[model samples]
Target: MADRSPEVAEDVDVVVVGAGILGIYQLYRAREAGFTVRLLEQGNGVGGTWYWNRYPGCRFDSESYTYGYLFSEELWRDWEWSEEFAGQPETERYLNHVTDRFDLRRHIRFGSKVVAAVWDEESAGWTLNTEDGHIVRARHFVSTTGVLSVPQFPDVPGREDFAGEAYHTGLWPKEPVDFRGKRVAVIGTGSSGVQIAPAIADEVATLTVYQRTPSWATPLNNKPISAERQAELKAEFASIKETLEASNVGFLHEAHDRKTFEDTPEEREAFYEKIWRSPGFAKMTTNYTDMMLDDEANAEFCAFLEKKIRSLVDDEETADKLIPRNHAYGGLRPPFVTGYFEMFNKPHVELVSLREEPITRVTETGVETAKGLREYDIIVWATGFDFGTGALRRMGVTGTDGLELTEKWADGPITWIGVMASGFPNLFFPGGPHGAAGNNPRYGGTQVDFVTELLVHARDHGKRRIEVPRHAEEAWMTMIENFRQYSRFEEHGQYYGGNTAGKAKAFLLNPGGKPKMMEAIGEAVSSGYQGFLS
Candidate 1:
């Protein structure tokens, strides 16, 4: 739906900038609170990340059963997902279903990307500028721009000179991509590459994967949703939602209960095997109490994952090359997929680990590395995002007193709850630095729910603005630094740490302990949204 009013553009009670999960939910809550709302979306339609990332094998790492709106019991019962990890098209459909169900699309301005947002101190409102030079005003603004929305192009030499077609999984074409018989080269073995490689291998003439770091990937065991299972989960929707919020990452699963070293060697081995067989990212680590702490214990778990990779790949040489050796086992983000290892069996598929033979440059028709020039018909830079702070930086956002957010967060992002920044007033960010995301594996929907709660509170209350107190922001910043100080990633060795040669400084996850972060949020909600208020 497009807002095509003939009347002059004017102010609204609240401006929700995005039509993604977070932005949509914010509009729902704001409307419920009796506030007139307007939504601004950059794309032609909604579904934010789902709207953009339509590449082959792009799917949610979280289970489909729990990766949706929990605020409405009706919505939960009515909707159904067809797989453990829903693909992009299905995700888009789900968003459409929600939009139609709630009648939200009516207020959204499709294809309208917000170019600039300036706070007006005198008017006590915000002057927001869209790309087409349309200006609108709003008393309150909520930015639900996702953390991973921006795509990052690697700064490899001759990258722009490539004669072949180049595409990023994050910014895939809406139309169908034909890899019918073309040779394809995929660089970066992060989540996107891990998921797409096997699927593309089945179609492309020859597939070559340039691996900079071998990600720890587990089987999704993805399957269609069953009627009986859907019925069973729907019955327990409230309980599931509550349980998800209690855990880190806001999802439920079986994790190792005992300490890493509490069990005997054989017992630990048995536990590790059990989780490996389980579905999705939940199986990456058994509900282990100490895998996150205790260096020795974490090392033991890493060794287990390494062994699994070795056993899966038939070629010992390839197996060794694929296994991650240096960083802490759980340091880098985990990848969930199907048939990732089997792709190596294909005669035409080759794995070029950047560690051994560093890429020198991109040639006119191929990639030139220390080993040799590997030519391909198409190249996919699945190199991932400039995460957490990139979008805010790239857009040139200036906060109070003309303080630049990019310059302020030069080393890393500093936010109270990955939601609100100190100097930025009346601007609420749903997915900000140090935002409260847990390891429960079902964190996305919870993120939407939690952020909406704050937005609704701000709208409902008569307060004209809410800005994070400077002291509060500073305290939270200290906490983030302290957590990083104790974690394995304090030092930059590879991508997991702060440094990678060309890897942009992007740390999406909040480093603070989930439990403590959630506690702070609870305190806020109880105290009239504690941290920020007029």
Candidate 2:
């Protein structure tokens, strides 16, 4: 529907798949390097994950200051964010602004879902078959598919019998969903559920939140950026960018001092409170740098959070249920919020801890739990996503010797630097398994940027194709497994950060520290991609 030539007669030198943040950057870099590029997206518009997840209160955990492009000074200067952490709208708008400014829309084919991508060894290219029966070929393939793109719906019996509107936060409707004077039952207490429940409760007559597992959440000091602060940031913009790149996660400030957690309990408490008052993702665990490394330090932080949650929620029973006691601190993704716990004080809002009463079935009216049947006009499955391999696996992508990528990654998605597969030649993957995780929020974004840079370099250097050696990939996989074996994090049952979850085994995050992970990438780069042959 967008202004583009028919796919029947279109082809390009390279195909940059998925129009998420990384995909957009890949297109810009490829085009700038004078390589013919075609961008394909399944959605009608740009902003991949943001485009689909339009649920109420959807937001970014990372602050707006360093969430976006660092490659262009002019682009960063032109767009000023309203808050430290930009909401979905601001993030979406910024992407749109970038798209418009760079004219990325021209090369992107909207409403085209790539169903299959089979490698053509003779031509050293990929033949992409779209769901609409359109086929296109490209010499190079770059998958910028997001890590958490695939929605994971739990197996609830009789779900098909539900008469009411059932929606997943990952697949929210494009149009506004009105919950006025209706009973709304929201499942899952992860980031999405925590965010949307509070905002939607204000409108709905009664809101019920079903929680499977409690999460560690702290206050998100979300506020409007003052003009004075904006001006100050503008004055020191160059230094900010430089700081972002040099750091492990590409954040503006250095990661919490590795020695901070070594202090006394009183000293640790004081330090954490100071950092908790600051803006951005570092507030929760970064203050005490050893929070992730040492169990004793982790317990102290968890106790601190338990106290905070207890103080916030008025109901003692609900507060205790809300407080996480089972998992170790920093095991799962830390939930951040503006006023999440405060919403529990509202009479209309209720928390149903599913551990006590597991969901049995979904009837025509609502869900039936072991405790009782709760009727609702609408049900929101805020039940997170399939991380790491799901995004690429769902698309049915294939590699050399007619090997299906999904089959190869059946055990778990493995890669040397989380960039390329052993069998997949000339295909680069950003945000794959064994790359960035936990302590490295900005690593995935920065790595994607770096991958784009390396791609540009390879193109400019006249390399027709490249592939990682099987031995190198095997070595990297062994290193990752060993890292997980030594770390005590597995006891916490956290996925990817090194837990033995069968389904989450393929998640793309290095359990080791970000500094070490980035160092590995730097070493790979210095070797002129030694393990990879062109």
Most lDDT-accurate candidate:
2
Q: lDDT by residue for model 1 over 19-99, one digit each (tens)?
A: 887788888877877778889888888898899889988888778866777778888888888887799999999988888
Model 1: how far residue 36 lies from native, Å: 1.8
lDDT of 1 at 519: 64
Candidate 2 per-residue lDDT, tens place, 48-85, comes to 88888889998777777777876677887778989887
TM-score of each: 0.92, 0.93
lDDT of 2 at 488: 43
Clashes of 2: 1
C-alpha lDDT values of all predictions: 0.75, 0.77
lDDT of 2: 0.77
Candidate 1, after superposition: displacement of residue 164 in Å? 2.0
